[model samples]
Target: MAWRPTLIFTIFSTILTQSLAKGKSDSPICGILRTLPNATSNYSEKYCILFYKTISHLAGDEDSTLYLPVSDALEWDVCDETEPPPASLDIENRYIFVSSENNCSALERASRIQSLGGAGTLIVKEKLHAPKQNNTDYNFTLAFIQNSSYVKIMDGGENVTVGLYSPEDSLLPLSLVIIWFLAVFSVGVGAFWSGKVRHKLYLSEQCGHVGEDNPMTCREPALPHEETSMNLSAKSIIGFVVLMCTMLLSLYFFYHILVFVIIGMFCIASGSAVFCCLQPLISRIPCATCRTPYFNIYVVRGTLEVRQILLLIFSFGLSIVWVVMRKEPWAWILQDILGIAFSINVLRVLRLPSLKICTILLCGLVIYDIFFVFITPFITSDGKSIMVEVAKGGTSQEQLPMVLKVPNFAFLEISNICHITDNYNLLGFGDILIPGLLVSFVHSFDLQIGTPCHLYYLVNVIGYGTGLVVTFIALWLLNGAQPALLYLVPFTLIPTYIVAAIRGEVVAMWHGDSDKFESGESDMDSPEEGVPNGSAQIVT
Candidate 1:
């Protein structure tokens, strides 16, 4: 009775499965780890778990390179089959590396390394929960290249290291690229503006001189306009370069750098374009402030909330389409009808009822969205069911003559939602960028008395959101400002990296069973059942 890792791993996986919420399976974890930092820019992340499940049987472990999403953590959970495995309850409660990770509050994430026999078991979970999480302005974002053409074999004897890197690494490269492009475009625009300004001044001088100095007697040599052109162009260029470089460097260190990156990029592009191109052109025209740089804005739309209103409306419509695409209608029924009724009842008892209508409307909208966006996509797919089959000792495979064909429908079906939520994946700096720009805009128009402009207030509410008291005061004071929202829609496809790596590992794990067949076919699923010779189970 030699030690059997397959049997052991099966038990561990079963325990893990018991904790899953039907189709949910801690879906919020990924929201916290991947999407939030990437999209929201609201929270700081300390660490994450990188569950490495080998879909294919790996031969030797020397070549595998594991890249963890976070920089430092409290502990690592290694599900090794041969080693004395840190106590079961300890593994469950995460005592495996608790001593090293004592700085963090708790393990921020959990992951699994699922695979089949003749194999070593490994799962890496890093824990970093320091109380200083609040004091520092830090960003913990991760971008992994997990699924490549390499690292497929899933044999038991293998070694892997989960490499670490600091947060905001992705933003550095992305920001650098954007700033460089804009800097070049700004210079080109300035040159065009200088030409237009000169022409306007020439026309004015000629018109003024027609009645006085002998019908263009000397031409005045144009007053050496080159000096003025050089200064204007130089100022614009210097202003732009300085601003962009400042923002880019700021992102390298800020915890909420995602906001800076997104907002800073747009502001620099838009502001520079206007000052360098549109401003000069408009100045040459009869009117100065009358120039509208972009159509969706107010200077062009004439204080009509219609454009802003329409924008919000269109965004709502797109959100509706998103709900439809995700395929959940019941959630809509509950949120729109029942969720509304429930909120009214709760509000009635509370007695501070000015917001009853607004409350119901807001709650209903959120409820319907949840059903359409998050709740509706909870049904399990055929691939997910396949994991249960293999887990239960029911799957088989066959080996082809030249190449081995191990059909692991299960490996292809598992979820990657867990990994995405680690390290505030949803909360990135760019998430905060647009809002910051809005705040900057409001600052541009900041006033101490009377109501601020509707447009300024609108941008602030729709983008960054002033707190409840602030919103109340602003809306009370302005009465006409309507804001739009930054709606996030999660796509339906599983991340390509997670899908590819898992499938590859499943194939490698079943490599041994290939000895049963020659090539181009597997014995796991029989030809008679139309299961395509997928073989399984080897007692080595």
Candidate 2:
């Protein structure tokens, strides 16, 4: 119904408005300096003022105020308290440049510029420092610029002009929307696919009734060894967290050399992931079902279907192509596709058997994420987050392929303010895969219980989406890098627990009885009891 879409839109609008209202009211103003061609400089350059603070009266508007530079040559001593403005200097209606090294306070600098009839004052400093004293006495618009910008202006002579403006935050970046959709799609499809595979394996384990025409019905189940997923234990979760910490530190210290190694690993892993994701679909094709002769390789021997071989070649070829063309503008499409496939494959292969293990894993990772992203900045020399720096490529030309990147499609020029030149929003694979394990486990639990409509699965998936929205909201309001798992784990885990408790399956779900399939098999053996003879029940 049309009302469904309308209701969703209404909810989204409400959330957006509420989130925006919570954003920082004292957002910093940005400035752009444009240098015109002069005798010494042939080409023009535009520099962004990264560090700046605007006066109280100039805080409301988003419009840029353009000001031409004064023609007077600025000397370090010009703004000194001992030296007043030169007799010949004319600063009327022009923005005057004042360096912090002039041994004068910001208020004093602004007052001197105001007395000289200047339109505004630009104070250049190495870093931003709020005035210890009140700045209300001087009314002219005052802002700070980086020392580098000041040097450039001095070199550019009087041909430099600046435009100051406060950037308006986008209601929501389209990149975030796309990333959310991709995350939901990846987790949902991966869970469903995992459940289907689990169901098939469960059915294959059963000893069906023997038929005279087909004795193979009594044969032992021949499940593929490679399809066996690793069930995470409590200790393994802790170990996984430790390993993640080690890897992050390694990447931070040795990023230049290790990035290529990680790229190679991603190529192999993503290729295999693609093959795993596509093999099932391709197996259904009649023409592609041809099998190759069994071949022995050292201790292993197996026959591969024609489709499998073709998919292997195609998947690896695609991965190699992405590595070669990753710098291209359109390459994010391929990267996202491969990344989603990789996440789905990981969710399918790593089984969190119970709610207990899921809780342990999710909580451990949430702490890990928080420590690296939020805590390490205070400890590091450069005062940058280790996690954020590693994720941002850490001075390397190659970025880790373990994230889903969506190019920002917003019309606003907010990328410069955020210090992101590529204008891409990234969601780490851990954010999707860790919580996705819980989602997948719940789907399997739903299948085990034969819950009508998969209520647990549905609720957990919706919780995950809600958590992602909260993460984005926090990111927008704080205007900083966020630990997504801080929001994701609680949202996904708590809802599933609540649903389990309400359904009175809390104990069962917490332990996740693995023998349920065996019990179901035993029940299937007695055909006259209810189940049809020799008929297999497949959970869809």
Candidate 3:
């Protein structure tokens, strides 16, 4: 066991000595890391050291460099080892292996290269999601080059010089950790508080008395029973088909137009939310004898307050600034504020009353995610994983407005070399919104039954947090892009269902029944109808 590392060091040392005779003191050639016709020219270097920039395997600045002349390996089906690449005594040559196959794992290819006496191996994966490499106890250095750089290296043969910049550090940024916790807590609080407020509003609407002066104080409103309707008429089906076609064509021809349209919608929604929040304060301002309050001029969807109008103006100003300046940091902050508002509103309005509905929807999505991400490649000759390609390409050039990037607090100070580097974590809204919906449903369920302290909401939120933690662990452990919903859907769904079953409420919950009130009721003042003493009975 001890001899293994020693043997590797010896081999590396031998390669370095051989490369030194052909080497110079100059730095490696600089080329932009991309693949395209206009990509930077590649430069050949007699000596180079491979660098690993991942979170777990960070090669330090002071690590020893092994100099070897780069050489290209002949293209072969690495999956079928029956015809392995011919072995050579040229241990001084670092090999580059390119493959588009799905059968062979990256580690397997690396191990095979080491057996063939490669000083180091560079794998150029054609697919978007590369195979995971868990075992680092290899005999030689290895690096995974992605996208355009791979093409440049392949075309340049031994002449391409590639460089990888070291990240701030291997440790997760403290600000990132703080932001993540705050996001989860805020989503939870938003969902719970909004649901409770909505419940109270529904109570007020159903019963006429809204003020403290009302006499019937003890009376509680009937639990809401939403109507579930399915209108699959021919006209509806035709309308759906037309809408889809229009969307596809619009996205194809006018992608930027769609982007601006979405921005406009976000402005309107954010403005309305700001107005709703400030309405009560705006109403208190006294107006002159016959004239209306100044805030009345601002009203659009409702009696919009002056501050709310200002919020809309500010939002529009920020959008304009982002377009003109292209200041990425500002765009990041503006997107974050808008994204949070969208999430809260979605959680507030979207309701899944039946337990059966939540389970079926989430479970179906889990299978959908796994199939597209992991299994589709084998079934079809698709060049890349659909989900991986979408996620990678969607964020940058296409500029798909699918995610909100949290601002890295560490980057606030302007310094050449600050230890507190910005660690902006870009998370897709679907990752937050989907689970938020389920967690919101559970909290609303708690409200419906008059449960104290939102017990079920806490459990389901814990399940969501656990699932997300496990998803990250799997990403590191697997060393590839994973469908997050593959882990999340099950973790959130199963535990909450178990909790419901244990309390003997699964049957009633599955059918969207409430135990505190009868199946049908119109008024809260009936002697038979009112708030429960404590927790309601768990109806089977």
Candidate 4:
């Protein structure tokens, strides 16, 4: 178990090193280009454009609106001509489109367009470059558009008018609030349920060891085979991270072919997760006690209760239905439900043995996330982050199922124009599961110490929520994707360590003395004993 943490850390470090070595420069401003609704073009209505303002003061406001008609430059390469083409009435008050492959710079082209009375200049290019800034004063907005957009506009003819606007921020706050609630709920419930399961397992183990002279009869309770939690080792954590990197790369490179495979895997995993979530609740029903005859199938080890069997079939059936109806407007609801269940189950099954291991895992993953989200753009062939690309499903029509997505509920006409009508605010499962492991650990620790109120668990959960709020604020301010764990790791780990230190239990928490609780005497006479300390054994 100790090896998992080390393995995860090493993998993250390797990814960071490789990304830093191949880094390149990027433009400061990338805005959205949306075609008006009345356009006759058959092309995509929206595009991502890199904008540069000639007026230094206007640089601060990327979201400022610029609505103008577009016109082709007299010369395809605006820089090829020595003097601006004969001024035409058609060019005045319109955006001039030009090829960027010409020898002249973007500034020179913008100056020529300004001289021609054009409202703005749109330079078309296949490759991106940082436009050289000049001190000379000019009064026009200049931007670079992909050749694809230029071709589409040209094909659409004169009816295609475009506008530049920043991505919408209206839905960010609401979406973040919802996500925060879901994450907190998942962690709290998972920790509580995990503690209960461990206590039950401990009691069962104690009952099994009762001596012959004891009057009490020992009867084994029917429990799930996967009752034991797997503690993460330092080396296994490194291996796990390495595996994650490999999987990310694989998805990026082979998404077209592998997307179906990933979808199938998600269905299976989500089905099992759903079963795990529903089993306890259904089992509490009196009718659920009915059992089916024992079967000799190698996969199923013991006789399953009637309700458990029905629940398993129903869970799988739901996943299948989701897959079939995934393109429907209401499909996201099912996806979110499946995703939340999966995250909670993961937090319950995976254990971080100590605070030290938790710190290593969180810190390593933060660096890994930062590299992929912020740094990989410079290194990848396309000027896009590998993490974002994979999350967006690359060229595949099917999105990866590892995120919780909430659609923007706020109504805005611009949202439709920008082709964001169906867009969703996304939070990856990693964001929840990684920090959640620490929350789970502290809750178990609280039980071991026999605290009156599980102080560490509550504090860390609050810290996670605060950190998530900060992350959303950063995203809104920067108007870009942020590395959430960068904020989460500090907010969660520091406060937890401070609490432990104040109580003078730093050493105990560091090494996870809770593991020793398993050897403590069990009170067989009292069935109502509180949760015991130590790792829970998996009953086979």
RMSD of each: 31.3, 10.0, 16.6, 7.9
Residue 536 shift from truth in candidate 2, angstroms: 27
Clashes of 4: 21
Question: Candidate 1 local accuracy as lDDT?
Answer: 0.24
Question: What is the alpha-carbon RMSD of candidate 2 to the true structure?
Answer: 10.0
Tens-digit per-residue lDDT, 164-261, candidate 1: 22221231233223322332222122222332333344344455557375555544443321211111122333443344334323432242433323
lDDT of each: 0.24, 0.66, 0.48, 0.66
Residues 1-540 of candidate 4: C-alpha lDDT, one tens digit per residue: 222332232232223221111111233345567676554655447676765433312222234665678887636557756654645536788877877777887777887778768778788887644566654555567777778777876777665677765443454457657777887788778776665565455456566557345878867562333233344467766766667778678877988876787677668667777887887798687886666654544223346777778887888888898899987757878888887887776666666667777877788788778878889899998889987777666666777666676765542333444344245677777777788878887887777677668888889889988988888777656657677788877988899989998998788878773354344432322333221221122110
Alpha-carbon deviation at 113 in model 1, angstroms: 19
Model 3 misplaced regions, further than 4 Å: 1-58, 62-165, 168-179, 205-299, 319-330, 379-381, 394-396, 406-425, 513-540
Best by TM-score: 2
RMSD of 3: 16.6
Model 2 lDDT tens row, 197-222: 66555555443334334556644453
TM-score of candidate 1 against the unseen true structure: 0.22
* CA shift of 232, model 1, Å: 11
For all predicted structures, in order, the TM-scores are 0.22, 0.72, 0.55, 0.67
Model 1 clashing-pair count: 93
> After TM-score superposition, what is the CA distance of residue 249 in candidate 3 from its true location, in Å?
11
- Residue-by-residue lDDT tens digits, candidate 3, 153-202: 55654434333222242345454464456447645855685567556645
